[model samples]
Target: MRSLVLIGHGSHLNGESAGAVYRYAELIRERGLYDEVVEGYWKEEPSLRQVLKTTRSTDVTVIPMFISEGYFTETVIPRELGLGHQGPVPGEGIARVLGGRTVRYTLPYGVHPSMSEVILARAHEALPDLNPGDTALIVLGHGTTRNENSNRVIYQNADRLRESGHFAEVHALFLDEDPRVGTWPEVVRSPRVVVVPFFASEGWHTLETIPEDMGLTGEVTVFEDHPSGSQTVYYARPVGTHALVAEVVLHLAEEARGASERGGDEDRTHAEAWHAFMALAQEGVRLGEALITPHGSLYEIRHALDEGRPSDALTTVVTPEGLRDLTRQDEGGRHRPVHTFRNLPRGWRAVLSVTDLPQGVHNLYPAVVEEGYAHHCHSLRATPWPTTARRQTGIYAKVSRATPEQVEAVAKDVCSRCLKTRLWAGEKLPRTFFTRVPGAIPCPEACTYFIAEAREEVSGKRSQGGHDHG
Candidate 1:
């Protein structure tokens, strides 16, 4: 039978993300709609790669457990699964994916019509003791300044909820971007506020962040003596995790099964990948360093290649041909590096890697396959380089965090990124990649980074940015 795989953005910080995905998957599986129903996650196990391998079904459907057709749905998922070279299409699409599987990729959850009832049901469940007319409703979302599309359904649904005339006021707030949730107290006119979190799960945002951001004393709490009066914010569970979402997943899967194919024949290019790249560019993710071959170096390297001479200054070149190609295209304008290295969403993602993230193995300096792709994680993980004194080449790194305590936090964040990326690149993630900094006192050439014992405080422009990335 055709298997169904539910993809979720699980949390490295909390297990609730995986729990919610499993809950939804179990609910769907109990119906026995498919031969197998398995779940996959980005941040936690069983990873998307592991799930793919575990499922022996030749025919399958992968539904993104996201609210909208945003970055995860568009870029990351497609890249990981090797489905859409172009990027995510709206709603659903049929793609001849890897492993020769006829995978039907579904749109995120929020677009389904059944979701409106799900949200309303959640509100009704949360407001058993209060009156809907006296209570204001807030659709809290994790909005993004990077991609405006992330919250389009949120505001649209908020308007729909307001039109229902069941609440005193209906407003939308986001944790990331404007309409900041903090400003709700000033505009909220009701004594009771029911917050239906528009998150994928009860991960960081729903359980920890939204509650902390709202300054609630408990999950369901009463804040006495606000300017508006004593207000009780009823923090409802995430709509995505609500049992009704199982139906939504089935709805999307059925839609995917019914729809005809809409992807291109093997070689067609797409603007969606570029759009996702540009969207990410606006999001302010800094690279620890870009392993960019400068125009002069690029030219020198090309000349060397022509003359059969190896680059002296270049330690580990990404590729011999792509560097030459980039150098050939430099026409005086700022030459953006085709790729970069960082401790990020995963490891070593290209600055514009619309194709993949948790990109390969982490590189000390940047190297690339130009507009093409190249990452070395699988080989690296399977047969790791021995960090021997013979290849000892140490270099210091400056972490952005202020204190050693914060330094450890940032270090662990980077470690999490490595593990996250490794899952995508190497197909299996180590439970823990590192504790403090990776490398030893006598570092090796293939070692990702080398920092001595005790993180020396980075007190420069790099330190200016907040440690939230950690």
Candidate 2:
């Protein structure tokens, strides 16, 4: 069996950061090329460390959904996947024999040559009527001085676009380094300008920061009385969110799969764990806000609040992707990154064959089945709050400064908002930080959202003259 895993850099503040990755995974799954297609996130649940546990395939190819080969691609991902410190192999990625399976890691999607086509397509689609010869195109990236490769792909694409001669002028801009995005008004001399974000997904950067920095009022911002003489600025969506990204991912995975050497028999750990979960589901199981009930060979999952309703009465979803979209938001349309949140909207049911239950449950509450099985086997590792906090840097570094009382306060506040049973607690927090419901989903550590809130509380207290034990 073969599998494809798409890794993304999810966000604690914005749930939309992983949206493109999930969409791409779903699109690829629809093609029925691989036995399994799953998604992992660096900052979200079903994280890079745990995603492999959900795949039963012997030949697994992992493609980072990021736009560049930077810190995450080079260091963090390998570390999380237990792939050791092996370096890339020119075109083919690091291949290793892991737990009786052949796992091949591929470069990020953005570095591929086909991405230039995606960028051009997005630019043209944004303003089909505009003449490319008269408009200047700017590719925006989040460049970092720490990793030169972070901006390398953006420059390469800009050069490619210049070679295409489709645009009158092409410029590459970064959010962190030189020729910043804010200087786009001065950098391009064309009467019409198109700015395409080279990042993955629409998050705080694309949705909020980039627009504010570029002085863009909307998708098509027109400046009637500007210093550049009535310039019209057209902003395209991030290149990574384009539909062609799924094709790029498949190409990357197929390339790695062809180069990979088949090894020992497939590991049955993940498959066994999944089967065990299915066996448990046969009787009936409550996972977070979802209630799974067996109906002979098939199973029906619905919101716990809608347990009494018939499947036909609720909004029925047959595919895992459809169920994922349906439950991505709450009743009021707020994004729910923490899927185990108690606020699952009422009157929605998912009908799945036994074969589809794994993906279906994963979309509803990621890694719940695998983690639950590990917990049952007494092998699940939970990261303590202090350990998770000490690993934080940058804006979240202040989280380590939180007092015991402040830590407990933040834990209580955040846990109350989530449905998962906390398995990791601080020194000050009791084992029962919150009442653990029977069949409650497991939270192995303090989530990114909780950490962000803790950082805010710590920073606020410090500003208010709170004593710093550190």
Candidate 3:
């Protein structure tokens, strides 16, 4: 049997990226098509090197677990894995081949031929309570910054879906550029529309930003694009987890198997591999929010995630001074505290206006796995806060990637030692240092320092004598 290896751009904070890939791997293995079906990632565990070394299969098939085929498929994976050109043309493959294996790398699942059906299927599955006449189908994609080619994949499918007369109207929107969500309602003809994200994982954009802007209400937090109360918006899951994707991967594996059986000719295997890769590329699409890892710098992880190509979208949430100026004045006629502003230090404000929240049409993230997910504009804690937007907020953070032994030793120091007294320069401190400041950027630039500080504070105290330290 053939071997299948699926790789994802995973996240430590989001938990959904790896979870989606694991589910896909389990489905593929359950089919009994390959002698081995494995999962690997660009970030998190079961890394590229580890997965390859452990598989032990002389003949391997690698498929990028992504929603877009722009950079990761083109440059990053090949460069890092020593892969050459993917198809069957002579001298087209990468120069450095690893181990003693004859390998094949397939295109991303997004570009597979079977995706059209899958898209239609996903839409139908997400909106079971719908009539075609009243429903508008909007296909949302992570619009790219560096590559113009990324939007084409999503647009192609939206055009085809529209031509098929599947819904009241079919439109495509991107997260990166203009013709943004704020502008969507002006163009839509239908009174109600369902948006489906073409993303690989359920991360920040899908869970938070899109719904907040669109004014949607739902039950499951993971699937946040459904209509709120009488709100008409609807959302579907990312295309990666669709059932047809499994068939696409299996089909590519079968083609590769056929090439192998005919003869061990490198050209033939390469040719079949190339088609699969191309198909995968056509199906893939990406947006701006990226995966960051501690093993690499922000720039390095960005390169690893996008094949060293400059993104068409902004990499980080850089809230400029101009943007911060938009914060509303308090009822006391003050501009509010400077600490409430993000990105800036001390006291500054960024203010953005919700000028037009369209009624009939709504904005949504391109990739969502469920419908009826909900989020509220709440405070970071359950404690009530006096603000224009009032709702509870949850913080996301990564505590440790260090081994268990290292974590335990640090725990010991904090429990027993009165380490909170120790300061940056041996001065006294308050507990607020350990807690996050309200309205600040969730992750500081020096995230590593935060992790280190938390570990040291807890472990250092424990080592001394079970003191309730900060």
Candidate 4:
């Protein structure tokens, strides 16, 4: 069996940071090229450290959905995946034999030559009517002084566009380093310019910071009384969000798969756990915010609140990806990372085949089936609050100084907002009243958001020169 794992840098502040990664994973899964396709993140659940354990496939291909071959792609990800200290070299790729499986790591998609095509396509899509010869193209990247490779891809793409002679001028701009986005007016000579962000996902930087720095108000911003004369600017979405990028990932995965030897057997334990969960689902089980019930050969999954509603009454989602997208946001249109939040909207139901049931459940509530199976087997490794706090580093390291009372208070507050039962807190704290569901999902460890909140509480108390004894 073979698996494909896409890794990205998820954010605690913005759930959409990993949106593109999830979308690509689903797209690839629909193609049915691999036995399994999953996503791992640095700052989100089903994290990099534990993503491998969930996959039953023996031969796995890991791809980084990052914009550059820098710190994250080169250092952090490899270390987290136990691949070694250095990342895979571009084009050649790298492979390692670990834990009875052959894991192949590939160069990030951003460094691929195909990215230049994605950038050009984005530029043309943003301003189709405008003539490329009269419009200047700007590839905006979040460059850093720490990693020179981070800036290389941007320059390479700009040079490629220049060689193609599609645009009157191609300029590369950065958010942090020299030739910043603010200097766009002075850098470009064309009267019309299109700026395309070279980042992976549209999060804080693309949505807020880049627009603010570039004096852009909307898709088309016109400057009448500017220092460099009147010019019309068109802003394109991030290049990584383009649909064609999925094809690039597939190309990389195929190349790596051809080069590596696949021999290890499937993870029988994971298969057994999935089978056990399926057996429970056959008798109707409530997992997280979903109420899954078997209807003949198909499983009908709906919000736990809509248990009694007839199938015709609720909106039916035909595809698994459709249901995943439907629940990606809340009623207010904000991204909800905690999929098990009680507010799973209303009047939406999904009918999935027996084969697709596991993917459907995972899309709605990630990693729940595995956790449930582990809990049933008495093998769930629930990390306590103290151990979780001690694992923190950098600014979050101060979380260790928080009093037990403060930790308890924060856990109660945060867990109340989420539907997952806090298995991490162990027997020290009583279970939240709402999370007493018999087959509810389990949280094996404190999430990054919980750690952030704990750090804030500890910092606030220290600032006020007060401590809570209780």
Candidate 5:
């Protein structure tokens, strides 16, 4: 059976981010849809690269468990896995593979047809008394200045729902551009309208801004004197936790399977192999490290070549000629590096500690590892990484040798790096509950505690703009 990989845009700070993906992976695994199912994240452990190493199925299908078909779906995941539609070399269309490993990539979770069910479910929950001519539904999404495609998906969902004739009106509003959610009152003529968030998780904007801006109370409420004196506004929960999301993953997997099967006649270009080699090298680049000349790098290179992106190989090099010269110099290399990288394949497993908190890993963990994946007890656990680390109440990663306290420090370090990036960019998220003094040196010593506490505080402060996950 094929291995199914679920990739999430995880958070080092918010443990729930990873929890959601794992939950879905487990659910799917329980149904026996795939022989092997695993979870990986862009930010957290058992990363996309490493998670790939843990699976041994001849065929692999990757589903991007993101909320939208934006950057992470379009750029980041593809960049990481070396999959996309491109011809080989200058003349022929070649089938390129990743490090000689053949895998198919499906569209993200957000763009799947199954999402319509969640939207309809949210709308129904928002307006139970709805009958046709009375209540309207407004889907709100956090449109980005960076990617217009994000809003496009939201609008498309709106259109699909609108065409279904479920509500008197179904429209979409964005946080960034025109037809904004804050200005939604101007466009609506309905007496009562349900506002549903089109976000992945109940993060800052959905929990705070839209409701505050729309003059809502509780998760669902109505307001008068907002649009017209008769108009009532109700806010609904985010569409992330719905059961229909699984269908979305299946749909994406099918698409990837089709594409991979149809592209067999393509040429064999070493571009993918070259690209993978460069990616591995770049990981070590920050430490001023370089990859071994021939065999050590060949596996990733071959994978890339099979996937059909020779140009990526060319770009991975500091100089294209340098990479070409290296490949030519060692054209007769052996597969010892491949043997070193390949290991015993392991299925997805977790030992979660549950709690009452809604946002922490503790709550999300049980759900993520529920049905599809395996649960490991302390003694039978595959690695001690889950036990040794200083774990936040809701988070886990594979750090075998480290103590729990050491893992806690690593978590804090990830948060600190992200915080530094935010500061350097002079950027502000849509909903921020607390702000540090400008140029304040963040104390890294208590970083994990601060991150968990800061997010908890932010989630509780809905009036200030952060989402209330609780």
Candidate 6:
């Protein structure tokens, strides 16, 4: 009997870590794809090494049910299966001389483009009204700086989904990397949100860590009290647990069978594969700059300047003084408070000819996003704001004429005291520190320390908590 062993990064803490893996294994076994379909786990029994011994088949196919080509896929799996190498051969898919039987290892299923179909399905399943034009789809990933290659597939998939333009925005959020999952919501200018875990299986990260951090309770949950409306934040199941992944596994095994028959001459070694993947990733990043970057996106424009490649497309630089001038005289005959508009397309004209929001304000949205998913713009400055070009007026502002040290002291006090109290009380504080006066580039470099609750009474339009004005 040809044996198939599904290796999962089982959790000692989350008993459900291996639950999906076992379920899929049974599904595959019932199809008679392999005589024996058993699971091995790193943190659960039977251990990978021990499980390999139990496989009586001369032909054994071991699949790593992970989302990336990380340490687990390349190093740990080979070492455990006694493949006698630190690296794997990509596209070859077969390991010879492993415990005197032919072993085949498949590419991490998460990398396959087919997974996008499953993600889209999950989003649609959770939200039947999921509109790509207005909803932001965040593919939450387990990005580790450990191996730069660990998240290539994640970025690729995110971009892949973005290319479809299904959601108003599609971005990858890493638990470990910038644009972390915890605060992406604030940056997303969407009326609806759908977060799909890029993990192979449903476990603590998907079940406990994500929902707790996101202030979510269940799948297809609603994030009410949004300033905009009762917006929905759809939480989808892990991509791996999707029924289609079994087909990906079967496809990988079939490819391995082909490579095993052909004798592995054309395959690149694991190190070579990593290098190739890196080169591809870097090249993709280079090309990605042109397409996804909307023209008037000040964040990307600043990023270019910071990188020393200020784009010619960024000709209209709105300085701090320019912003103050714009704010002084408004069409409403009232001085409009500083608000922010981000991810603006190049062709988008300013709605209200107002002052230039501080450059620091541009950084704020990106910081919240780069930090991770947040409540759709949970108010740090005050409840009066808009992510869209539609600006809200008369936000209570506390500008500081004090020196930088004074500003820092106030910020420290608010951050240290009020933030701690709110956190301890299990209330979610805004994931960002406010640091700018509307329209004015103040004497102090960073001095907007508005440490109000996540929200205060704005008006009948919005309340202390709720959706952002997308």
Q: Which stretches in model 1 have alpha-carbon errors above 4 Å?
A: 11-16, 43-46, 97-99, 129-132, 219-230, 257-470
Candidates' C-alpha lDDT:
0.53, 0.78, 0.46, 0.79, 0.50, 0.53
The sequence of per-residue lDDT tens digits that candidate 4 reaches over residues 1-470 is 88889998876546667778988987888788888888888777567766776778778889989878976777767866778757447576788876666788888988888899999899989999767668999999999997888899999999999899888899999999998999987778788999999988777899999999998999999999767678999999999899989888988887773454453578776788788878778888777667788989999988888889887898898677778878877877766655665667777899999988888877787776676677666677888878878756556789999898887778666677787778777643233212335435667877766776788788774223222221
Where does the lowest 10-residue lDDT sum fall in candidate 4? 461-470
TM-score of every candidate relative to the true structure: 0.54, 0.80, 0.51, 0.81, 0.55, 0.51
Model 3 residue runs over 4 Å out of place are 12-15, 85-98, 129-132, 219-231, 255-470
Candidate 1 accuracy as TM-score? 0.54
How many Å off is the CA of 81 in candidate 1?
A: 0.9
Off by over 4 Å in 2: 85-91, 96-98, 127-136, 144-147, 165-168, 180-194, 202-235, 256-266, 310-313, 385-387, 397-406, 416-422, 425-443, 460-470
Listed per candidate, the RMSD to the true structure in angstroms reads 19.1, 5.3, 23.1, 5.1, 20.3, 28.0
Between prediction 5 and prediction 6, the one with superior TM-score is: 5
- lDDT per residue (tens digit) for residues 185-232 in model 2: 777888898889997777679989999998889999988776768888
- Candidates 2 and 4: which is better by TM-score? 4
What would the per-residue lDDT of candidate 6 be over residues 285-342, giving only the tens digit for each residue? 1111111122232322232112343355343444532322332223433321111221
Rate residue 248 of model 6 by lDDT: 79
Worst-scoring 10-residue span by lDDT in model 1? 435-444
Kindly give the stretch of ten consecutive residues in candidate 2 with the minimal lDDT sum. 426-435
Q: Give the winner by lDDT: 1 or 4.
A: 4
On TM-score, the stronger of 2 and 6 is 2
Clash count for each candidate, listed in order shown:
2, 0, 59, 0, 36, 18
Residue 247 lDDT (model 4):
88
Report the C-alpha lDDT of model 3 over 1-470, residue by residue, as the tens digit: 34567877654233344667767776887787666676666543344433554343556777777666666676656543556543221211222235555667766667655676777887878778656787787788878677776777788888888888778888888778655664566666665677777776666787676766555565222222323322366677767667677776676555542235432223332234334323322333121121122221111122123344444442332222122222222223332111121111212211112221110001111101000010011111111111101111111122333344544454344322221122221232222211221111211011112233444443443233222211
